[model samples]
Target: MNATKYIILLLLLPLLFGCSNDGINNNNRYLPNYGFSVDINMELPLYTNLQFTGNPVYIDQAGVGITGIFVMNTGGGYVAYEATCPNQEISECSGMFLQGITAICPCDEAEYNLFNGQSTEKEFPLKQYRVEVVNPSVIRVFN
Candidate 1:
């Protein structure tokens, strides 16, 4: 009500909203924030298989994703997902395997659709990275 009281209230206002999760990216907690990014050059031997549609390519490189990065061309576009199980923390068994059209988590046998990163048995879907076609010959995946 008074000038002193208003000053104190204003000073404390920002503190009340500081140091919180903000809740926008709450799902990143499930896996370590190792970062997911890769540039797929279709002409390279390692990524030559990815030039086709519906073929899933699993890259087990370190520091790319939690377990690794799984990428595929869904006929519509390219998509990438973190290779760890979305429902749990990163563990020895939390790394998923690429099946025909799904990523199967060995920890709990949770099956996630690779097309849209959805799973019926888990509350969270697979963590997807952003895909950008850099050129006709290359595409970059990142989060």
Candidate 2:
């Protein structure tokens, strides 16, 4: 059409289509379709009749911006929780610790039960990553 009309269209093109590399859908929202995975090797003492305690290992998934993994023995089994705080959405918040079957957040005193991933004092629970026990010495955490 006219040169003036073409110029106007060009100026609005960037706004019409989002400026980010993430693809924009029909609803004018950017969607992130891809994520990352991490495999961590955790060394725990082999269960024996003489040994009653096992060492806890922390795994940091750097690709996903994870600071650390909080691993603790629950007497019956092992429980793992992410170090990030769900309330503040910060990776540097105080980590979680095992209290009975629950994981307590040191930042806001939010306690989450490791048994079912439910909060005891607060309504929101800690964000939990998927953990797969590969063997006696390996565990993989994934989104």
Candidate 3:
């Protein structure tokens, strides 16, 4: 009886310390959280460049992201990230511009890798969204 009780206590101990927060505890202080969904057709003339790897395209119309979104063809697949710099609050200079495989933030000259969205100068990473390839010609981004 004593052995059974000890085993039950050990099993139930993990339940007592229960998770303090919901599974989704992530809270980014700088970047604004904006829900958006966008789809791009690679066949279109404007987005035709995306068909090639290492090319990134900026989409800024209606509902793409807070300021805009930068979608890139990483050769392996696709990646989409918020255009605003993740290190600081959205300011006039927070909008990032692409230069080769990196997005540069003019405010502090912070650079982020377009392929992985990792920062070269800081620990802040670009806000990324989920990408789904509807077909060979169409890709969707949502968060």
Candidate 4:
């Protein structure tokens, strides 16, 4: 109510609401631009005869840190995403697992459907990278 009290409240207001356990602004914080590209043939072998059934493969690109390539059994389609948790950005506990049609984050059990990249329960979605199948054996991942 007083002038001194108002000043103290003003200074503490930002600290009160701007802080989070994840240490990032949940509402207004922008996701970092982690644009990168990877050539698949030079990185791993593409099994053409052996059918891939919704299995995720971890790949470490030269420039990009770590990425997960989810190969969907449906028509040989694939979805590639960064191995970083969107909720906390903890690189160590960020890899995802293929659960039916979703990729479950190991950190907080945040499940994201690899089909659309949307979180199954949470509002946030996993950061997805663009994938282009150059040929039957080659693929390119870009952010």
Index of the highest-TM-score prediction: 3
What is the Å distance of residue 17 in model 4 from its true position? Answer: 38
Q: Mark the 10 consecutive residues where model 1 has the least summed lDDT.
A: 19-28
lDDT of 1 by residue, 1-143 (tens): 69999999999989997755422242656875565567888898888878888788898876787778889999898888888888887788988998888899999999999888889877888888778899998999777
Error of 3 at 4 (Å): 23
* Per-model CA lDDT versus the true structure: 0.82, 0.51, 0.85, 0.60
Model 1, position 92: C-alpha lDDT score: 86
Residue pairs in collision within model 1: none
Query: What are the per-residue Cα lDDT tens digits for candidate 4 across 1-143?
Result: 69999999999999999854332122313246555777666234553421365545556545663444444333556666665566665566666666566677788888776656667577666666666788766777775
> In lDDT terms, how accurate is model 2?
0.51
What TM-score number comes out for model 3? Answer: 0.80
Candidate 2 weakest lDDT stretch, 10 residues: 24-33
Clashing pairs in 3: none
Instruction: Identify the superior model by TM-score, candidate 1 or candidate 2.
Output: 1
Ordered list by lDDT, greatest first: 3, 1, 4, 2
TM-score of each: 0.77, 0.48, 0.80, 0.58
